[model samples]
Target: MTGFCNMVIISLFNWIYILSFFVVYTADAGVQNHHVDKQNNSKRLLMDENYYTIMSRLDNLTKEVEALKKENALLRHSPIAFLAELTKTVSGQNHQIHFDQVKVNIGNAYYPSHGNFIASVNGLYQFSITACSTANHYVVLELTVNTSVVGKVLAGDTGYDECSSKTFLIQLSSGDDVFVQHKSQGDYLLSASAYGFPSFSGVLLRAL
Candidate 1:
Protein backbone atom coordinates (compact mmCIF):
# COMPACT_ATOMS: atom_id res chain seq x y z
CA MET A 1 0.00 0.00 0.00
CA THR A 2 2.87 2.39 0.72
CA GLY A 3 4.34 1.65 -2.67
CA PHE A 4 1.00 2.21 -4.30
CA CYS A 5 0.61 5.57 -2.63
CA ASN A 6 4.11 6.58 -3.76
CA MET A 7 3.26 5.61 -7.33
CA VAL A 8 0.04 7.65 -7.13
CA ILE A 9 2.00 10.69 -6.00
CA ILE A 10 4.42 10.29 -8.92
CA SER A 11 1.52 9.90 -11.34
CA LEU A 12 -0.12 13.08 -9.99
CA PHE A 13 3.10 15.06 -10.53
CA ASN A 14 3.47 13.66 -14.05
CA TRP A 15 -0.16 14.55 -14.85
CA ILE A 16 0.51 18.11 -13.71
CA TYR A 17 3.56 18.25 -15.93
CA ILE A 18 1.56 16.95 -18.87
CA LEU A 19 -1.18 19.51 -18.34
CA SER A 20 1.30 22.36 -18.27
CA PHE A 21 3.17 21.19 -21.35
CA PHE A 22 0.06 20.19 -23.33
CA VAL A 23 -1.69 23.53 -22.86
CA VAL A 24 -1.00 24.44 -26.53
CA TYR A 25 -1.91 20.95 -27.86
CA THR A 26 -5.13 20.26 -29.87
CA ALA A 27 -8.29 20.03 -27.81
CA ASP A 28 -9.12 16.47 -29.08
CA ALA A 29 -5.69 15.06 -28.09
CA GLY A 30 -5.92 16.61 -24.62
CA VAL A 31 -9.39 15.10 -24.05
CA GLN A 32 -8.16 11.60 -25.10
CA ASN A 33 -5.20 11.71 -22.69
CA HIS A 34 -7.44 12.75 -19.77
CA HIS A 35 -9.84 9.88 -20.45
CA VAL A 36 -6.97 7.37 -20.42
CA ASP A 37 -5.81 8.67 -17.02
CA LYS A 38 -9.36 8.23 -15.61
CA GLN A 39 -9.35 4.57 -16.70
CA ASN A 40 -6.02 3.89 -14.96
CA ASN A 41 -7.29 5.54 -11.77
CA SER A 42 -10.38 3.35 -11.74
CA LYS A 43 -8.26 0.21 -12.18
CA ARG A 44 -6.08 1.14 -9.20
CA LEU A 45 -9.09 1.75 -7.01
CA LEU A 46 -10.42 -1.71 -7.91
CA MET A 47 -7.12 -3.33 -6.98
CA ASP A 48 -7.16 -1.62 -3.58
CA GLU A 49 -10.69 -2.91 -2.86
CA ASN A 50 -9.67 -6.44 -3.84
CA TYR A 51 -6.71 -6.34 -1.44
CA TYR A 52 -8.99 -5.44 1.47
CA THR A 53 -11.43 -8.20 0.53
CA ILE A 54 -8.66 -10.80 0.52
CA MET A 55 -7.41 -9.67 3.93
CA SER A 56 -10.90 -9.87 5.41
CA ARG A 57 -11.35 -13.43 4.13
CA LEU A 58 -8.01 -14.48 5.55
CA ASP A 59 -9.02 -13.19 8.99
CA ASN A 60 -12.32 -15.09 8.84
CA LEU A 61 -10.51 -18.33 8.02
CA THR A 62 -8.22 -17.85 11.00
CA LYS A 63 -11.20 -17.46 13.31
CA GLU A 64 -12.81 -20.63 11.96
CA VAL A 65 -9.65 -22.59 12.61
CA GLU A 66 -9.58 -21.44 16.21
CA ALA A 67 -13.20 -22.50 16.73
CA LEU A 68 -12.49 -25.99 15.37
CA LYS A 69 -9.56 -26.36 17.71
CA LYS A 70 -11.76 -25.53 20.69
CA GLU A 71 -14.39 -28.06 19.63
CA ASN A 72 -11.77 -30.78 19.30
CA ALA A 73 -10.46 -29.97 22.76
CA LEU A 74 -13.95 -30.31 24.19
CA LEU A 75 -14.36 -33.71 22.54
CA ARG A 76 -11.14 -34.95 24.10
CA HIS A 77 -12.53 -34.30 27.57
CA SER A 78 -16.16 -35.15 26.67
CA PRO A 79 -17.72 -37.90 28.72
CA ILE A 80 -19.40 -39.74 25.88
CA ALA A 81 -19.39 -43.46 25.15
CA PHE A 82 -21.69 -46.44 24.51
CA LEU A 83 -22.20 -49.99 25.83
CA ALA A 84 -24.25 -52.70 24.16
CA GLU A 85 -24.64 -56.44 24.27
CA LEU A 86 -25.12 -59.46 22.00
CA THR A 87 -25.33 -62.62 24.10
CA LYS A 88 -26.36 -63.39 27.69
CA THR A 89 -29.64 -64.25 29.35
CA VAL A 90 -31.19 -62.62 32.43
CA SER A 91 -33.92 -64.03 34.61
CA GLY A 92 -35.61 -63.82 38.02
CA GLN A 93 -37.33 -61.00 39.95
CA ASN A 94 -36.28 -57.63 41.46
CA HIS A 95 -32.68 -58.12 40.35
CA GLN A 96 -30.31 -56.35 38.00
CA ILE A 97 -30.51 -58.01 34.62
CA HIS A 98 -27.06 -58.81 33.33
CA PHE A 99 -26.07 -58.80 29.74
CA ASP A 100 -23.58 -61.62 29.37
CA GLN A 101 -22.39 -60.22 26.10
CA VAL A 102 -20.97 -56.75 25.62
CA LYS A 103 -20.67 -55.15 22.22
CA VAL A 104 -19.49 -51.68 23.20
CA ASN A 105 -18.66 -50.51 26.68
CA ILE A 106 -17.18 -47.10 26.17
CA GLY A 107 -15.01 -46.07 29.11
CA ASN A 108 -15.69 -49.55 30.56
CA ALA A 109 -18.74 -48.09 32.27
CA TYR A 110 -20.74 -51.28 32.31
CA TYR A 111 -19.82 -54.07 34.70
CA PRO A 112 -21.00 -57.63 33.91
CA SER A 113 -20.99 -58.90 37.48
CA HIS A 114 -23.03 -56.07 38.99
CA GLY A 115 -25.10 -55.69 35.80
CA ASN A 116 -24.95 -51.91 35.80
CA PHE A 117 -23.24 -48.97 34.16
CA ILE A 118 -21.53 -46.30 36.24
CA ALA A 119 -21.36 -42.94 34.56
CA SER A 120 -17.81 -41.58 34.40
CA VAL A 121 -18.84 -37.99 33.80
CA ASN A 122 -21.91 -35.86 34.27
CA GLY A 123 -23.81 -35.77 30.97
CA LEU A 124 -26.88 -36.63 28.97
CA TYR A 125 -27.15 -40.32 28.11
CA GLN A 126 -29.28 -42.49 25.83
CA PHE A 127 -30.35 -45.95 26.97
CA SER A 128 -31.97 -48.80 25.03
CA ILE A 129 -32.91 -52.38 25.70
CA THR A 130 -34.40 -55.36 23.87
CA ALA A 131 -35.35 -58.22 26.14
CA CYS A 132 -36.58 -61.52 24.67
CA SER A 133 -38.42 -64.30 26.47
CA THR A 134 -39.76 -67.74 25.65
CA ALA A 135 -43.39 -68.75 25.05
CA ASN A 136 -45.93 -68.11 27.84
CA HIS A 137 -43.25 -66.22 29.80
CA TYR A 138 -43.39 -62.45 29.96
CA VAL A 139 -40.46 -60.57 31.49
CA VAL A 140 -40.84 -57.03 32.82
CA LEU A 141 -37.70 -54.94 32.47
CA GLU A 142 -37.29 -51.57 34.07
CA LEU A 143 -34.68 -49.02 32.97
CA THR A 144 -33.26 -47.44 36.11
CA VAL A 145 -30.85 -44.67 36.85
CA ASN A 146 -29.62 -44.77 40.43
CA THR A 147 -32.65 -46.61 41.79
CA SER A 148 -35.04 -44.31 39.89
CA VAL A 149 -37.16 -45.87 37.19
CA VAL A 150 -36.90 -43.80 34.08
CA GLY A 151 -38.26 -46.20 31.48
CA LYS A 152 -39.61 -49.73 31.14
CA VAL A 153 -40.32 -52.45 28.55
CA LEU A 154 -41.90 -55.89 28.58
CA ALA A 155 -41.15 -59.02 26.56
CA GLY A 156 -42.74 -62.46 26.14
CA ASP A 157 -46.15 -60.96 25.47
CA THR A 158 -45.85 -62.06 21.86
CA GLY A 159 -46.99 -65.68 21.71
CA TYR A 160 -44.12 -67.92 20.56
CA ASP A 161 -41.24 -65.48 21.11
CA GLU A 162 -41.34 -62.05 22.67
CA CYS A 163 -38.99 -59.10 22.30
CA SER A 164 -39.40 -55.79 24.09
CA SER A 165 -37.23 -52.88 23.11
CA LYS A 166 -37.21 -49.18 23.85
CA THR A 167 -34.90 -46.18 23.72
CA PHE A 168 -34.88 -43.08 25.88
CA LEU A 169 -32.59 -40.24 26.85
CA ILE A 170 -31.89 -38.72 30.25
CA GLN A 171 -29.46 -36.55 32.15
CA LEU A 172 -27.11 -38.09 34.70
CA SER A 173 -24.42 -37.05 37.15
CA SER A 174 -21.01 -38.60 37.55
CA GLY A 175 -20.99 -41.97 39.37
CA ASP A 176 -24.72 -42.44 38.71
CA ASP A 177 -25.85 -46.00 38.02
CA VAL A 178 -27.82 -47.12 34.94
CA PHE A 179 -29.17 -50.60 34.33
CA VAL A 180 -32.11 -52.77 33.35
CA GLN A 181 -33.77 -54.78 36.09
CA HIS A 182 -36.33 -57.58 36.22
CA LYS A 183 -39.62 -56.19 37.58
CA SER A 184 -41.87 -59.21 38.23
CA GLN A 185 -41.35 -62.56 39.88
CA GLY A 186 -41.65 -66.12 38.46
CA ASP A 187 -39.80 -68.09 35.78
CA TYR A 188 -39.04 -65.54 33.09
CA LEU A 189 -35.81 -65.32 31.06
CA LEU A 190 -34.23 -62.65 28.86
CA SER A 191 -32.62 -63.90 25.68
CA ALA A 192 -29.31 -62.52 24.56
CA SER A 193 -27.65 -63.91 21.47
CA ALA A 194 -24.14 -63.99 20.05
CA TYR A 195 -25.48 -62.25 16.93
CA GLY A 196 -26.47 -59.29 19.13
CA PHE A 197 -30.09 -59.54 18.01
CA PRO A 198 -31.68 -59.00 21.43
CA SER A 199 -29.69 -56.71 23.72
CA PHE A 200 -29.39 -53.63 25.92
CA SER A 201 -27.34 -50.59 25.02
CA GLY A 202 -26.64 -47.13 26.36
CA VAL A 203 -24.48 -44.21 25.31
CA LEU A 204 -23.35 -40.92 26.72
CA LEU A 205 -24.99 -38.55 24.28
CA ARG A 206 -23.39 -35.36 25.49
CA ALA A 207 -21.36 -33.93 28.33
CA LEU A 208 -23.08 -31.61 30.76
Candidate 2:
Protein backbone atom coordinates (compact mmCIF):
# COMPACT_ATOMS: atom_id res chain seq x y z
CA MET A 1 0.00 0.00 0.00
CA THR A 2 2.76 2.42 0.91
CA GLY A 3 4.68 1.54 -2.22
CA PHE A 4 1.68 2.27 -4.39
CA CYS A 5 1.10 5.60 -2.69
CA ASN A 6 4.75 6.58 -3.12
CA MET A 7 4.68 5.64 -6.79
CA VAL A 8 1.59 7.76 -7.33
CA ILE A 9 3.26 10.75 -5.69
CA ILE A 10 6.37 10.27 -7.77
CA SER A 11 4.24 10.29 -10.91
CA LEU A 12 2.62 13.54 -9.81
CA PHE A 13 6.03 15.17 -9.23
CA ASN A 14 7.12 13.99 -12.68
CA TRP A 15 4.04 15.59 -14.20
CA ILE A 16 4.87 18.83 -12.44
CA TYR A 17 8.38 18.71 -13.83
CA ILE A 18 7.14 18.16 -17.38
CA LEU A 19 4.53 20.90 -17.10
CA SER A 20 7.08 23.42 -15.84
CA PHE A 21 9.32 22.83 -18.88
CA PHE A 22 6.41 23.14 -21.25
CA VAL A 23 5.36 26.46 -19.71
CA VAL A 24 8.85 27.95 -19.97
CA TYR A 25 9.44 26.59 -23.46
CA THR A 26 6.09 27.84 -24.70
CA ALA A 27 6.63 31.31 -23.26
CA ASP A 28 10.07 31.47 -24.86
CA ALA A 29 8.68 30.38 -28.21
CA GLY A 30 6.30 33.34 -28.29
CA VAL A 31 9.18 35.83 -27.75
CA GLN A 32 11.50 34.34 -30.40
CA ASN A 33 11.08 36.01 -33.85
CA HIS A 34 10.11 33.69 -36.69
CA HIS A 35 10.33 34.83 -40.32
CA VAL A 36 7.00 35.11 -42.19
CA ASP A 37 6.41 36.74 -45.58
CA LYS A 38 3.45 39.04 -46.33
CA GLN A 39 1.71 36.13 -48.05
CA ASN A 40 1.71 34.08 -44.83
CA ASN A 41 -1.40 35.63 -43.18
CA SER A 42 -2.85 32.21 -42.54
CA LYS A 43 0.42 31.03 -41.00
CA ARG A 44 0.49 34.05 -38.64
CA LEU A 45 -3.10 33.35 -37.55
CA LEU A 46 -2.13 29.74 -36.83
CA MET A 47 0.79 30.97 -34.79
CA ASP A 48 -1.49 33.26 -32.76
CA GLU A 49 -3.81 30.37 -32.01
CA ASN A 50 -0.90 28.25 -30.98
CA TYR A 51 0.39 30.98 -28.65
CA TYR A 52 -3.00 31.36 -27.00
CA THR A 53 -3.30 27.61 -26.61
CA ILE A 54 0.14 27.38 -25.06
CA MET A 55 -0.64 30.21 -22.65
CA SER A 56 -3.86 28.52 -21.57
CA ARG A 57 -1.96 25.30 -21.01
CA LEU A 58 0.67 27.16 -19.03
CA ASP A 59 -1.96 28.74 -16.79
CA ASN A 60 -3.61 25.39 -16.14
CA LEU A 61 -0.29 23.74 -15.42
CA THR A 62 0.66 26.52 -12.98
CA LYS A 63 -2.52 25.96 -10.98
CA GLU A 64 -1.91 22.22 -11.00
CA VAL A 65 1.64 22.69 -9.75
CA GLU A 66 0.45 24.90 -6.91
CA ALA A 67 -2.14 22.33 -5.91
CA LEU A 68 0.45 19.58 -5.98
CA LYS A 69 2.81 21.64 -3.81
CA LYS A 70 0.10 22.18 -1.23
CA GLU A 71 -0.75 18.49 -1.12
CA ASN A 72 2.88 17.52 -0.98
CA ALA A 73 3.51 19.84 1.94
CA LEU A 74 0.68 18.26 3.88
CA LEU A 75 2.15 14.83 3.27
CA ARG A 76 5.63 15.99 4.27
CA HIS A 77 6.77 16.18 7.86
CA SER A 78 9.13 18.78 9.33
CA PRO A 79 12.59 17.25 9.63
CA ILE A 80 13.73 19.80 12.22
CA ALA A 81 12.06 20.09 15.62
CA PHE A 82 13.62 20.84 19.03
CA LEU A 83 11.94 19.64 22.23
CA ALA A 84 13.40 17.27 24.83
CA GLU A 85 14.06 16.77 28.52
CA LEU A 86 16.26 14.77 30.77
CA THR A 87 15.17 11.26 31.75
CA LYS A 88 17.87 10.55 34.31
CA THR A 89 19.16 12.51 37.30
CA VAL A 90 22.31 14.39 36.36
CA SER A 91 24.61 16.16 38.80
CA GLY A 92 28.20 17.30 38.74
CA GLN A 93 30.05 20.45 39.68
CA ASN A 94 31.96 20.59 36.40
CA HIS A 95 29.91 17.99 34.54
CA GLN A 96 27.39 18.71 31.79
CA ILE A 97 23.84 17.47 32.16
CA HIS A 98 23.21 14.50 29.87
CA PHE A 99 19.48 14.37 29.15
CA ASP A 100 19.71 10.78 27.85
CA GLN A 101 16.08 10.68 26.60
CA VAL A 102 14.85 12.88 23.77
CA LYS A 103 11.07 13.33 23.61
CA VAL A 104 11.05 15.27 20.33
CA ASN A 105 14.10 15.80 18.15
CA ILE A 106 13.33 16.80 14.59
CA GLY A 107 16.75 17.81 13.32
CA ASN A 108 18.71 15.56 15.67
CA ALA A 109 20.82 18.62 16.50
CA TYR A 110 20.69 17.87 20.18
CA TYR A 111 22.35 14.80 21.65
CA PRO A 112 20.97 13.81 25.05
CA SER A 113 23.74 11.26 25.38
CA HIS A 114 26.34 14.00 25.18
CA GLY A 115 24.44 16.84 26.89
CA ASN A 116 24.86 19.19 23.97
CA PHE A 117 22.46 21.20 21.81
CA ILE A 118 24.21 22.34 18.66
CA ALA A 119 22.43 25.06 16.80
CA SER A 120 21.67 23.96 13.25
CA VAL A 121 20.84 27.49 12.09
CA ASN A 122 21.48 31.03 13.20
CA GLY A 123 18.43 32.13 15.19
CA LEU A 124 17.01 33.59 18.35
CA TYR A 125 16.32 30.89 20.93
CA GLN A 126 14.63 30.45 24.27
CA PHE A 127 16.18 27.90 26.60
CA SER A 128 14.92 26.53 29.89
CA ILE A 129 16.37 24.35 32.63
CA THR A 130 14.71 22.77 35.65
CA ALA A 131 16.97 21.35 38.31
CA CYS A 132 15.54 19.41 41.23
CA SER A 133 17.64 19.48 44.32
CA THR A 134 18.03 16.75 46.88
CA ALA A 135 16.43 17.38 50.23
CA ASN A 136 18.67 19.41 52.55
CA HIS A 137 21.10 19.74 49.65
CA TYR A 138 21.53 22.53 47.11
CA VAL A 139 21.45 22.83 43.34
CA VAL A 140 22.93 25.57 41.28
CA LEU A 141 22.83 25.22 37.49
CA GLU A 142 24.28 27.52 34.90
CA LEU A 143 23.01 27.92 31.37
CA THR A 144 26.03 28.20 29.15
CA VAL A 145 26.02 29.27 25.51
CA ASN A 146 29.28 28.82 23.68
CA THR A 147 31.20 28.53 26.94
CA SER A 148 29.70 31.80 28.18
CA VAL A 149 27.38 31.74 31.15
CA VAL A 150 24.09 33.28 30.19
CA GLY A 151 21.86 32.41 33.16
CA LYS A 152 21.76 30.47 36.37
CA VAL A 153 19.27 28.58 38.54
CA LEU A 154 19.76 28.27 42.29
CA ALA A 155 17.50 26.13 44.41
CA GLY A 156 17.43 23.34 46.98
CA ASP A 157 17.71 23.63 50.74
CA THR A 158 15.57 22.52 53.62
CA GLY A 159 13.64 25.77 53.19
CA TYR A 160 12.55 25.62 49.53
CA ASP A 161 10.82 22.82 47.56
CA GLU A 162 14.21 21.83 46.15
CA CYS A 163 13.25 22.74 42.55
CA SER A 164 14.88 25.49 40.57
CA SER A 165 14.20 26.43 37.00
CA LYS A 166 15.67 29.10 34.76
CA THR A 167 14.80 30.30 31.27
CA PHE A 168 17.05 32.29 28.94
CA LEU A 169 16.49 34.01 25.66
CA ILE A 170 19.50 34.54 23.44
CA GLN A 171 20.69 34.77 19.87
CA LEU A 172 22.73 31.84 18.61
CA SER A 173 24.65 31.35 15.41
CA SER A 174 24.91 28.09 13.59
CA GLY A 175 27.16 25.53 15.31
CA ASP A 176 26.83 27.25 18.69
CA ASP A 177 26.04 25.07 21.68
CA VAL A 178 23.79 25.77 24.65
CA PHE A 179 23.66 23.51 27.70
CA VAL A 180 23.27 23.43 31.45
CA GLN A 181 26.13 22.79 33.80
CA HIS A 182 26.33 22.03 37.48
CA LYS A 183 28.09 24.85 39.36
CA SER A 184 30.09 24.30 42.48
CA GLN A 185 27.94 25.13 45.51
CA GLY A 186 28.91 23.10 48.51
CA ASP A 187 27.76 19.45 48.59
CA TYR A 188 24.32 20.24 47.18
CA LEU A 189 23.21 18.16 44.19
CA LEU A 190 20.44 17.93 41.56
CA SER A 191 17.87 15.33 42.46
CA ALA A 192 14.82 13.75 40.85
CA SER A 193 12.09 11.69 42.42
CA ALA A 194 8.67 10.26 41.50
CA TYR A 195 7.44 13.65 40.34
CA GLY A 196 10.19 14.41 37.82
CA PHE A 197 13.89 14.98 37.44
CA PRO A 198 16.09 17.72 36.05
CA SER A 199 15.44 18.71 32.45
CA PHE A 200 16.76 21.07 29.77
CA SER A 201 14.57 22.35 26.97
CA GLY A 202 14.78 24.97 24.24
CA VAL A 203 13.21 26.05 20.99
CA LEU A 204 14.19 28.29 18.11
CA LEU A 205 12.44 31.65 18.37
CA ARG A 206 13.27 32.65 14.78
CA ALA A 207 15.95 31.69 12.30
CA LEU A 208 18.40 34.39 11.34
lDDT of 2 by residue, 1-208 (tens): 9999999999999999999999999877765533234437778889999999999999999999999887675445334455566666555576677777677776788887778899887777788888777677677778898879899888777865577677888899889988777767644555455646667778776665
TM-score of each: 0.58, 0.57
RMSD of 1: 14.4
The candidate 1 region of ten consecutive residues with least summed lDDT is: 189-198
TM-score of 1: 0.58
lDDT of 1: 0.76
Q: Among these predicted structures, which one has the highest TM-score?
A: 1
lDDT of each: 0.76, 0.75
